[model samples]
Target: MIPHIHRRTFGTGSRPVLAIHCSLAHSGAWRGVGAALSDIATLHAYDLPNHGKSGDWDGQGVMHDTATDMALAVLDEIGPVDVIGHSFGATVALRLAIEHPMRICSTILFEPVYFAPLMADDPGFAGGYRHDTAAYDQALEAGDTAAAAKAFNSTWGDTAAWDTLPEASRTYMAERIHFVRDSAPFLMNDSADLLAPGRFAQATGPVLLMRGETSPWAEDLNGAIARRLPNVQEVSLPDLGHMAPITHPDRVATHVRSFWAAQGQGLRSARL
Candidate 1:
């Protein structure tokens, strides 16, 4: 059984859109996107366990369990919803759509980081990802929390990003390094099942998969995901990286709203 998770609802529209943020982020991160779609969507964002205001999870910190927790929250508070998730959150959303297809009318994901597809297609790429991530993993092993956070963020985000962080932000991230460290292994290693043939075949929904053009490894990773989903439309944003949702929320919101608006037509007609 999943524990009760904390959620924040934005807008007053009757049509609901459940937003799940990436690792180390929270519901507040979805504010910009929520605001962008306020005219047509009631955004329901949740803080996954150990991320934001939500309490720490009691059991394992795996993606499937996290997805279940989010699903439970939807059942209790919002019922079925149009879903949007970013990075790790996107991975969870994909699982939920497959496991509970009836609950999601449409889905939008920003660089879901499952990595299984890349690994399967290119051994060298998989090895490089592990090597790059070793810096963060090693720091965790050596009990250098700040270094771990910096290394992990630098690889997926910006190289100088860590040093530029304000002291308070640095301290907070350092404090949460343990959660990041523990969760990283499950996300990176649990690819066998996630990449299983036809894993996404059962998920029936219109999916929008967006990735930043500057993202280092996303081309292959996101491409792999797009090929699997039955009805998926992939969009690439120029001059943006993996952190676009956080760094360039307004621009990202524009693209997202456009995609949602198009999908909303079928939903609106169904409602009437």
Candidate 2:
């Protein structure tokens, strides 16, 4: 059975946009962006299973199962709608758009950590990835949760950012490291066509891909995915990094709202 998903709704606009947050984050991550776009869209921000108010998912950590639950949640609560997601959530959004094409009208992804295609594109990348994973595994094996998180965060976000986290926040992230670690296989090792070059023909929708200028890895991944998408627009935010969604909502929201505005027009034309 699919588990119940916890969500927070914002705005009263007729058009709905479902916003999914990245790992280590909850629906609140969308608060600022949602508020900014509220004038044009009714945003439904959800907490992924085991993230915030959500309960444990009955299914295993397989990403497709999680995507199924997420798709169902959209069907049950909001029906087919446009979507916005970041990092891990952005990866799931890719699956939903690919597997359930009719359900997602449009998509906006920020730094989607879909690494499988990258590995496929460059075999040498795997060596570096393996080396990093080795370090992360070693820290975990040594029962050094802090070290593990530091290693993980340093790669995804920034090493210095981990030290800047508050003690309580660091503790919370350390506790949930297992979920983060378990998702790596699905993100980086999956063999699905969604991760293949030029395999986005199945995802029939307008797509907006956003990346921070300072985030090289994410930018490269986004670029690779963009090349395959049937319909896509790419944007790079100057002086921003992987955590732009959390740290610079106003700027992020500006780009998102612009996309939705264009999408809203398309929706209206379709209704005519």
Per residue, candidate 2 scores C-alpha lDDT tens digits across 1-272 of 65667888877777788888888778898887777777778878888877788776654657546754765677566777888889988887877778777778888899988888788778898788677678778988898888887777877664358879889877866876766766767777873556554457888788899999888577679877887788898999999989888888889989987887777677534522
Quote the positional error of residue 56 for candidate 2 in Å: 1.9
Worst 10 residues of 1 by lDDT: 183-192
Off by over 4 Å in 2: 58-61, 132-134, 158-160, 191-193, 196-199, 268-272
List lDDT for all candidates, in order. Answer: 0.76, 0.78
Candidate 1: pairs in clash: none
RMSD of 1: 2.4
Question: What TM-score, computed on C-alpha atoms, does each candidate reach?
Answer: 0.90, 0.90
Error of 2 at 104 (Å): 1.0
Report the CA-based lDDT of candidate 1 relative to the real structure: 0.76
Per-residue lDDT over 1-272 for candidate 1, one digit per residue giving the tens place of the 0 to 100 score: 55557788877777778888877677888887777667777888888777677777666546457655665567556677778888888887887777677777788889988776666667788778768789888998999998987887887764346788788877766777776655554356653265666668877788889999988788888998888889998999998898788788778878877877777577644533
Question: How many Å off is the CA of 45 in candidate 2?
Answer: 1.3
